[model samples]
Target: MKLSIVDLSTVIPGETRHDALMKSIDVAQHIEKLGFHRIWVAEHHGAASIAGRAPEVLIPAIAANTSSIRVGSGSVLLNHYSVFKVAEVFCTLNELYPGRIDLGAGRATTGPITDFALQQDRSKQFRSDSDQQITELVAWLDHSFPDDHPFAKAPIHTIDSHPELYLLGSSAWSASAASQLGLPYVFAGFINQKGTRQIIDSYRSGFKPSAGRTGVKSPEVILSVHVVCADTEEEARRQIAPVHVMYDNLARGIIDAQMPAPDDAVKKLGGLPSLETYMKGSGKPPRFVAGTPDQVHEQLTQLSNDLSVDEIIIQDMMTNHDARLHSYDLLAGVFDFI
Candidate 1:
């Protein structure tokens, strides 16, 4: 199976945003050298723990720093912006990076408070905007808008270079949309870890072809999940401790996105009355996999086989930056991704 990475550029305690960004570049270069397939930077506005608020700005830096390995926004939340502008920005990125740019689109909303902060007001039409945006964005890329379409008349900075488009979704709604649009789809398994078998099957069954689109004719799917691989099972579990803390905090309405230090997580968990109950996984989904190289490989292979996906993108979330890089390095060696 093909392997890729989705770096949120998680900001650990005591690390500034600058540090997180620099580390993103460094990790990009490291992964390129290690023979990984791609590295996608995430977009999370108004979140303290995630430093990558603007993946478009980071794409050029990452592409320039590495000779290969595709770079992209794991997703640009399309609901908040103009589809025309999104098309222009990624067209420009494609011109700069040529064959290495990917335009992955999603519908995640920055909380209503942040939406007001950014002056991104939403009318009732906002719910349906994502489908329209994706359709228009693809037309803009191919310069294929209907002749009578306003955009066809005005044009949006015509360009020959175009980025490959992928729809990012956690459920069947997005999956069906991608299939119908003839675009590649990425399932956010880490977010919607349950009932995935039906989701993927539904996507394939709903697929419709758009003439001359190879991805549409023979759909491609990628699965993104939280993973941590270490030298041993015990060590890997220790590495993911902080990740659990971060998730627990978020579920409890804590806004801090900061990754706590491992020791800090241990101490903090002692007082969190919900920690024990949460770990017991009563109704929790299987959202993550943490273990030694062999163990992780087995689980990942099983997941890929069961879902029949073409690739897997690891969402790197380790508390320590070095450990994060090490995990990818180990996965590369195990899978011979190079």
Candidate 2:
């Protein structure tokens, strides 16, 4: 099974955002050591949830600490930034890491508004405008048209090179675009996973190879699932409290989107319909690969078999940095691919 690691440890509510930043490099290096195929960092903005919206800045530092594991963006909200800048950043990373960088581009408002945030105001731009712009934006980077060629007036142009790019989404809109563009697809569940089967089916079925494209043929699909691993089933259930609390916060209007909770508090996050389903499972969450090594392996194999996924991107947002690092290690032991 092809398994990868993705960090979405949103700064738990009330915790200092710097806390997550400080541990990111270490967590990345440690996960790499544990034999993960690729380490992807997420992008979210506005609130204090995740400090990863500035992935161009974080990916390089993570790369500097790792020797071989591929480093990529869970997604860079393409609408809010310039393709030239994105291309330049990834190209630089590729030059340093040499074919070990991936640019997973996304369409949503990666939340937080930055001084120079990747996601701009949603109210101002037309919905899907960014996605469409990204379509054109990507072309500019892949190959610069002749000086007089069409689309020369494009808003975001780049000297395309290095850093293989992938289109990411959990919906059919992204599927259709990625298929038509012939770029690899990363379907992220961290932000949204509903309609995934339809999305992937549409992606694969609608996929028509494009020779004129600059990237690989017949887009590859990566299903990024939320997961946490531990030694025992009981322990796995106990540890996922923070994650449950985080999701619970998402369910309720608390909207703090920060600070995961302890096990005691996870019980308070009880409004979710899926929570009961998850609680009833033998130490696992819906669409989440969480449990003991054996259980996790079974879950992963099930996921792979069902989706025919080319890769599985994991998010194990344990309570602390050390816990996260440990989860990474244990996950490696669980997956044979590691």
Candidate 3:
């Protein structure tokens, strides 16, 4: 299976945004040497724990530092930007890095206030026309706007190639939109884990290639999940403790300034067993897959086979930077990426 990564540029306790970002670049270089396929940074606005607020800015920084690994937005949150401008930014990156940029688009809101903050025109009522946005974005990237359309004359300023596009979604609605647009679909299993099989199958069955589109002639799917791998299963559980606390706090309307260290997180949650029980009773599939290298490999392989996908993109929320790096290294080794 092809292994990829989705980094949140997480800010652990006692770390600044700059520190988190530098660590992200370090991770990109490390994974590149380990033969990982791609590393897409996530965009989360006004979140103290996540430093990757602008993927367009981060993409170039990562690309400049890494020689081979693909670098792009995990999802640019298309709701906040113009289709033409988004196209220009990513296409320019593609020109700069060629064959190593991906434009993963999504329609998630940063938050109501942040959404309003991101809007260019606050006088207008907020509305999301993600379907139309995706369609227009694809047209702009492909330069396939109709002759009579106003944007037909607008230039994207890139010649020869455009960044690869992937529609990021966690629901059947997203699956349908991606299918209609003939773009690759990245299922956000870490965000929403329900009905995985049905959503992907629907995407494939309904897929219709857009005429003259530059990439993805057929249905393509990549499953993105949260994982924390360690040399032992117990250690993996310990590493993932911070993520559990973070989720618990979010559920209670608490926004942490930074992800807590593992010991502090475990203390906050009472214990790992309590966290596991709470997660199981939350009426969702376990959001994280934390285990030994062999265990993680087995679970991921089964998940891939069950979903009928060849690629899996992992997202980890560990507080220890060294342990986080080691987790990825172990994962790569298990997948024979090293």
Candidate 4:
């Protein structure tokens, strides 16, 4: 029943990226005081709506501002970077924050143009070797590289401890990869909710602990889901209206649109349907959970139990900053996190 958070540093309408980032630090401090376990900022590129384009930079900022909450990347896109460098960065962060850092790694392409832009070698086709990257990254952090390996001589050891590592994903392949690597798996349920149970079950059934690695003795799963909680069901739906519109805009190839205010989004969408009906009619895996704290608690508890996950990481992108904080605060009270 443990709860954590994944913040995207979403830039609300009329807000600057700087505003969004400072708000992220405020969010980390707010949630830490609410007794949440961790807060991981997301990494996205070339998206005007998202300010967390580099989690490595944000993690330390958030960690320095908070006293106890674990801070890390919701994921650093491993496909775009070198495993050695990624390991070194997190190792350095661990040296600073000690046990309060986590390195959640995953593979994804931001977009064709941005992906190409991220490539160091324009002459070569982009490599899709995140599987190998994850393996090597773990070895680097664990200092488990073989004596003959080229990276064995790399001075990448941590002083006191290494950041806790988790594999972030929304697919069966990621689940299996995490299991093979013997790392904790975080399923992005907000992104793709279908086959969630099966994917996590597969991860657990196939898990093989990495020899000489110092974390995750057994398969551990954390489910990250979108949620909007309020004092009443009607209010929750109102708060969630902007998120619905944001998704709709993304579907329509409107990538640069900032999140609209809830009332404005509700007007744009011609009003929202009842939560139950909206979820059932979407014909897609439920994209988000929205309701009163009691209702959200029930749905989240059911999702956690059904998937047999150890923790739940809540992800929400609401336009109203106070409302967003309020949503989490209400959930904390409901879950008795404080």
Candidate 5:
């Protein structure tokens, strides 16, 4: 029943990346004041619409700006960098903020093309072993390794504490891995909605205890999805039109740095003859929820109950900064978060 925010640091057209980042901090502070649980920034590369390409660099500024509500990466693409380096960066953050930081890692890439670009820029291997990365990351955080291991000889500087770690994913494989490792798991319902009930069930049923996850002997699950809340259900649906258009554009290889105005997006939707039909179809369930505050609250509550999750993290892709802020405020009031 806990609520949290996930900011994509999405760039609005006509605004600089600085503006988006500043808005991110503004949103973080706003939610913290409203008594939300946490605000996690996302990682997106080669996308003009997303400004949070480097969460490691942004986390410090955000943590400094907000007094409470935990601030961390929605995920650092673990496949892109070294485990030791990733551990070092977050370890430093934890040293500064102590218990106020989180380390959510995932295996997402910007795009197939961007994958090639990142590998070339870093001059490192592109393929990843998420299990190995997680094992090493936990080992580094604990400053413990098997007696015969190389890291045992040259220990990384130990900290009095470690950042709270969570595995982020939209797949069953990820659920199983997080469960087996006894780490908290976040299911990206917005990214992929198919078979989520089964996924959560699998995660809980498969959970195993580990020294690294003593804080969570049982499975901890959070369901993250896109949400657009407004004063009226109809208005909310209209406001989310641009977001739907944005998804369609991305699937078609079109990327816009800023969210197109909802009115404009409605007009553009006419060109896609099958778009309306797809929206009208009842065969596939939606990956997002758009409604008035009360309506959204009901749906979100039902979603959490259905999946038996501990928390629901809201992800909003709306363009209007004030409206985006208001959405969280409305949800807070509905959920009695304060």
Candidate 6:
């Protein structure tokens, strides 16, 4: 199985967009050389850490810079975007990058309550069903799947085929949505690990084939993992300190926690009660892929089986280009030949 790399190289706290984009481009280009299958950029709004908020613009920029790596919005929050516009955006991207474009749409807007509060008026309309929203997005894509309607007309660049579309869901809500619509489903193994098996099971077992999809043949369940491999275990641990801080910030409600200092986060959320029950049921355990390539690879080999994962998506929290590049070098040794 080929492994892919996804960089949530969000805008570090207090960093400018220009700086973040430059850093992201550097990372993307380096990973392309590293032979990652696809490089996806996530979209986040109202947060300092995430800068691809305007995926409409950012995705193309990143796609323009790289040649082979697949580029896409890790998701364009479906709830906040119009179906036609979202379809248009991905269709446009497909035109530019051809088969390298993917549309990974999801429900959450990346925050707990902030997304709920930002909606224009849908606070009550069609409330509480991310599955429905995902379904509608698929319908919008298939709007012209049956006939070449004017508005639904495929862009000239999108002539031969539509972009490979996938649903991004953190919970089980999208299982039915993706299966019924005949689209691939990507679980956000990063945030919530709850009911992942049941969700994947439901998606695989309940899927029905369509002209657009391969018909749920062992649906693609991409697990998000934090990896920081090095020559030695101690080196790996020190490098991965940033990842733990990143994790704490995410769980502690710093929706935009890109690279906050570990000390600050420890002061805020260190020693909090363990949500181990939740961890056992749905979420993945802490993934600090810091170790010799051999050790890290062994752990990931077991991780794939433990999670029944079809594909692994690594999110490198390391900031330094050389350091992450070194980690990537070790990672290639581990996952490249697979």
Expressed as tens digits, the lDDT of each residue in 1-338 for candidate 6 is: 45677665555545676777777778778778877777777766676665566666777778888888888777777777566667767887888788888887876644546666656675464344566456655655555344554545545332344677888776766777778777777776656554656677788788777654322444566776667777876566555665566666667776554565333433444432221111323335354444678876766676577667767777765645567778877777677642
| Worst 10 contiguous positions by lDDT, candidate 1 | 272-281
Q: Give the C-alpha miss distance for residue 16 in model 5, angstroms.
A: 1.4
| The 10-residue segment with the lowest total lDDT in model 2 | 272-281
Badly placed stretches (over 4 Å) of model 1 are 119-129, 155-157, 212-215, 271-285
lDDT of every predicted structure (CA atoms): 0.79, 0.68, 0.84, 0.85, 0.79, 0.65
TM-score of each: 0.91, 0.84, 0.94, 0.94, 0.91, 0.80
lDDT, residue 241, model 3: 90
lDDT of 2 at 199: 79
Across residues 196-304, which tens digit of lDDT does each residue of candidate 1 receive? 6677778888887756332467778898988888898767767778878887888999876577877678677763222111122222225777788887887788778
Candidate 4 residue 34 Cα shift, in angstroms, is 0.9
lDDT of 3 by residue, 1-338 (tens): 99989999999799888999999999999999999899999999888789988899999999999899988899899988887788878888998998999999998877789989999999998876588888888777677879999878865365346888899989888999989888899998878877676788899999998675555778999989888889987788789999887887889888745688988887887876321211322223358877888878877887777677899898987889999999989999999987
**Tens digit per residue, CA lDDT, model 2, 36-129:** 7888888876655666657878888888887888888878777667666677777777777887888888877433434233335545643444
Error of 2 at 60 (Å): 0.7
Q: List pairs with backbone clashes in candidate 6.
A: 11-49, 193-282, 193-283, 194-282
Compared with the true structure, what per-residue lDDT tens digits does model 5 show for residues 1-338? 78898898877767878999999999999999898999999888877777888888889999999887898888998877778888878888988888899998898756667887766465655675577887787777766678899987783455446788889998888898889888899988887776677787899899987676322677899888888888886667667777878888878878743567666766778632121111222222256777888778767777776677768788987777888888888988999976
Winner of 3 and 5 under TM-score? 3
Segments in model 2 whose C-alpha atoms lie over 4 Å from true places: 12-15, 110-128, 144-160, 190-194, 267-285
For every candidate, C-alpha RMSD to the true structure in Å: 3.6, 4.3, 2.8, 2.5, 3.4, 4.6
Q: Show where candidate 5 strays beyond 4 Å.
A: 120-125, 158-160, 213-215, 271-285
Encode model 4's per-residue lDDT on 225-300: one tens digit a residue.
8888999887888888988887788899998877888889889989864584224322233578889988888777
Superior candidate under TM-score, 3 versus 6 = 3
